[model samples]
Target: MESVKLFGTWFSPYSRRVEMALKLKGVEYEYIEEDLKNKSPDLLKYNPVHKKVPLLIHNGKPISESLLILEYIDETWPGPAILPSDPYERSMARFWAKFLDEKCPPAMTRACMRTGEEQEKAYEEAIEVLTFLENELIGKKFFGGDTIGLVDITANLIAHWHRFFEEFSEIMQPPLITKEKFPNICEWVNDYTNCSFVQENLPEKDKLAQLYKARIQAAKAATQ
Candidate 1:
């Protein structure tokens, strides 16, 4: 029997994406939850450079980074496809995923967490970045068209996690993400979160909200 183990955290969208992929592939894996404050020894051993969660260990070989882990899962497992088969479509999916990871999160975080001029700049930047995704979703139910695919999974941070910051932080004035501004993204969030597999893998929203609230409080405390 092949040995599969995953080191991840409950609240991390990165970790959840991997779990969603594994479950989608019907690949049973031993899940080891890691405390981000004090990570496990095996996690350090496997992902020495980053020393982060969402590390995948398969038959003694280790893989770091969530997107890479998702690709690995798609290639190694025999199940419903996580990435599109066609080379062009697959490349496009990877492109969008990379764009999301590289461009969206930092701007969105700064928009919510920073103040005054910095926050305004980040908010505008976030709107600009999100416009691309909003346009991409036009006339499509999912980024993957019908079924959830790599882009959809990678978007979990935007679809789900970002909401908590808006909900829990008072500093997020004027709001970076809104239904009026990005209707297509709103619909996509609805569709993505409503999916059964996604629902099963997501952390409880209330709990996540509290975590964000505490983190926001800590950030404010530090700034003062």
Candidate 2:
């Protein structure tokens, strides 16, 4: 097997998603922590276009972007596939994963950063996105049915980071996804987080919260 290396920050969901995929596949890899504030030359050299963390370097070849890296890992390693085997199921998984990739980040990022009317608008937008996911998850234990798959992986932010948003953000209305309101999604969160690999790989919540709090303060300062 070729050498695998991941450049990522501890607190990033994108990085965690890749880490989980590699763990699920039982692939051994080197983990390199990158500071987003002062990015290293390797990160810039490997992913000059995006200049982002979670870049997977395989056999000295670098792959950037979390979703794309996940696909690469799934293809390269192949055991306990993160994506389904059936072509149609794989297509559906890809669709929803891409949808969430486009939709979830902006809505939730805003919800995390702003505290006033702007935060309300972001919460509304996030609700719409989560509601769509909630309905899709109806009658299903996981987004990929019985087992966690691509869509489930893509929705990792909701399962883990969202609660922190509720705790940190001032404009809390609906309250971070509850079983009463989004039963399937709530159930999915439990199932996903309880998975042994995910449990083992997750970062400490207190540290993550503190990191995010500083980020939110910085974002607020930039606006003022």
Candidate 3:
């Protein structure tokens, strides 16, 4: 097998998604922590367009974007597939995953930076997107049904970094990740957190929270 190297930052939820997929697929790879401010020449050459973290290099070929890299990994390894086999179900999983990638993330990032009126608007948007997740979980244990699958991997943010948003964002006031507020999600957390791959790879919550807080502040400052 050719060498696989993951170029990522420590605190990016996007990078974590790829890492989780790689773990679930049982693929071994070198983990390279990148300095985003001063990206490695290899990273820039590999992903010149976005020039962002979470770039996966395989056999000297580079894959950019977390979701794309995930699909690539699954396609190549062909074990513990994150995506579903059934056509319709596969489409549904892709739909939800794309929704998270396109909508939920930007909404959360906006909520993190907004204050007063802007924050209120962002709060409404965030809740609206979160409602889809709640509704999607209605009859299914996981987004892909009984076992964790594609959309489940995409939605991994709720597992670890959710608290940082709830704690730091004054305007986006949904306590969705809390046990009392979301019993099923909370219940799911017990199994999700204990899963061997997830448990082993997850970063410490307190440390991650501090990093998340700092990133939010930095993003806010850069935009202002």
Return the TM-score for each candidate structure: 0.97, 0.92, 0.89
RMSD of each: 0.9, 1.7, 2.3
Query: Candidate 1: misplaced stretches above 4 Å?
Result: none
lDDT of 2 by residue, 121-140 (tens): 88888889889999898889
Runs in model 3 with CA error above 4 Å? 170-176, 179-181, 216-224
Cα-lDDT of candidate 2? 0.86
Determine the C-alpha RMSD for candidate 3 after optimal superposition of all C-alphas: 2.3
RMSD of 1: 0.9
Candidate 3 lDDT over residue span 173-215, tens digit each: 5553556656666666676778888777677788887887887
TM-score of 3: 0.89
Judging by TM-score, tell me the better candidate of 1 and 2: 1
lDDT of 1 by residue, 1-224 (tens): 89999999999999999999999999999999999888888999999999997999999999999999999999999998999999999999999999999998898998888889998888889999999999999999999998899999999999899988877778877776779998999999999999888999999988998899999999989999
Point out where model 2 deviates above 4 Å. 115-117, 221-224
- Top lDDT: which candidate number? 1
